[model samples]
Target chain A: MANEVAADANEHGSGGGMPDPMHQFEIKRQVELDVFGIDASFTNSSLFMVIAAILISSFLIFSMRGRALVPGRMQSLAELSYEFIASMVRDNVGAAGQRYFPFIFTLFMFVLFCNMLGMVPYTFTVTSHIIVTFALASFIFLAVTVIAFARHGAGFLQYFVPKGVPALLLPLLVVIELISYLTRPISLSVRLFANMMAGHTMLKVFGSFVVGLGVLGGWAPLAFMVAFTGLEILVAFLQAYVFAILTCIYLHDALHMH
Target chain B: MPQLEIADFAPQLIWLAITFGSLYLVMARIALPRIGMVIEERRDRIASDLDQAEQLKQKTEEAIATYEQALAESRAKAHAIAQETREKISTELEAERMKLDRKLLDQTEAAEARIDAAKDDALSQIKDVAATTTEAIVTSLIGGKLTKRDVSAAVTKALSE
Candidate 1:
């Protein structure tokens, strides 16, 4: 019965079949290519990621080339991006964490550019992939954990045992802390991936509806498209913020060892 | 391609390796160093500017203090000179007053001595006239023969003392 519905839906599409909104989440080959023992499939996700990286680097370099005391339009954008990430780090991790400014700034820029790039027509959101986000999150989790141990040595274990808790409730608190600690990467990764995937899928679905409804009746979906487009843009910025903020929190945990 | 469960993990691992390795390299090499250089440069510039400002301020304060001291010294010298001139003028006035008083005292003593001598001479002449008159009246009343020798002898004896 589901197949029937899917087939019926496919019939209405311009193509022989309807493309799954979920299809965008799938990793696939963009070119027939191979490298070494590995299949170098230049997938949509990879393409968009590379584009994001290039755009980030070029934007900063070009804007700062002048390095004017009085910033021009491009320079203001560059400075704003720098200050935004810097402030996030400072607010979360305090002055000591300022040393990690470059790392945090890079993370914010890479994620932000990827998100904004994905919003363009025919672009893939690399951040929407579970693999991508999970890897980024895992790195942060591992790095922060390593830093805590390196800084605190054996005392790192004390982070799990809250200081003021009574002995009776200590075990319970430790369990809760451990569970939360283990779930950090999961929560961080899922937030980015889910929001991006859901928003883009909705957009594709609505976009398809606009085409399917034809010009005269298409105004409804078209209006939804406009509103959803704006919403997606908002989501794009939000996801980057969420990701960067989580990184800062993780860094804070590392620095404070709490 | 048939779906292999192991193949599912392959993409994830590759992406993980690429992301981790690339990010590590970027941070260790390019991004961090550049950022560090920028922040350090800004700090050094601010420090130097503060130092220069401090030096300039000290110099300015020293100049101001020296200027004030010189002005005070000049004012003090002027006051001293005026004070000395006033003292000299007052002493001169005091000396002139004393000199005039001494001259007036000498003239007053001379005038008093002359008047005392004239009074003594006048008293002697009055005694001589009284003696003569008293002899003539005594003789006229008594109706006695009083000779000029006797009268002259008495008048001379009285006048002699």
Candidate 2:
């Protein structure tokens, strides 16, 4: 996509040879795949997802091959990630959320790896897509709702009905609560997607500026790009953290119903 | 934008499900439990080590107490034995001293009796000598041929007066 945009701009002599900053997000088919006629073509996005998964698995499985009581560097990383999510669940959702730790852990590692991988030159970011993040958020929303209903039966609906409100204002408040409750997945998904997309797009744009400006003038945008790249990496980790912690909070609400 | 392109969404979701699901399995089945086991094993090891140390400490205390008790008992026994031996020796010494006193008293009495007898014999010998001398003088002064018996009788009478 970046190549197409660069080609078009050069032909028209309009963009002054600046590649499309949005082009990095374009998906490319790696292997043509069809399942039940569903266009499940394996694209660069899927490939990165697979890479993220494999990397996460290998990092976890192989680093712990020693299972040393005193951990080495890789093992410490694995355990640190494990304990990080463990304590997150323990603190946010209490012990009842322990069973959901693997899911939360996978989610955090997946998003973090994808974001970090996207920072590398010419790698597709899986979390930068809306569908992916939305799918995850919706799944969590549905699961949390199911869990709440399963645990509390009909009392789960009482979550939206605030206590101690006058009957006249109760209906209005209930509608507002229901809307907010429904928007959880949207907010969760957009927060991750927007942060990733905007950061990458901005980096690409600044990177193009560095290329457009020759050596004598390029240093300014290049320096800004360097600092922005660092910020993007931090955002990558922070967004993943935010994603997992929000899931924990949702799970907490579902389990305890407050 | 490629993200809004509807054609890529299905594949992306499919792979997301596949990879995420498998990742969860790997963690749940293999990786996480191993880490938990290592931590659990370390904790158990430390706890058992502490327990063993406590037991050993108690054993040392018990041994020290036993040793002190034995020391005290032996010390008392030695004191009692010394007291008994002192009493026995004192009684034996008193008996020996009484026997020695009796032997000295008997020897002194025998010696006194012998001295008295010797003094009496010497006095009698002295009287015989006196009588003989008196008779001899009388016979020399008075007439030659006086009878020994008469002289002896006269001497006896004078001695008597």
Q: Which candidate gets the maximum TM-score versus the true structure?
A: 2
- Model 2 alpha-carbon miss at residue B79, Å: 3.5
Scoring only the A-chain of each prediction against the true A-chain gives TM-scores of 0.90, 0.94
Q: What TM-score number comes out for model 2?
A: 0.82
> Who wins the lDDT comparison?
2
- In the order shown, the candidates' Cα RMSDs to the true structure are 7.1, 4.9
Candidate 1 lDDT at B57 equals 100
DockQ of 2: 0.62
TM-score of each: 0.68, 0.82
Q: Write down the TM-score of model 1's second chain.
A: 0.53
Q: Runs in model 2 with CA error above 4 Å?
A: A1-15, B86-161
Which whole-number lDDT from 0 to 100 does residue B29 have in model 2? 92
Q: What is the lDDT of candidate 1?
A: 0.77
What lDDT tens digits, residue by residue, belong to model 2 across residues A100-137? 99889888998999999999987888889999999999
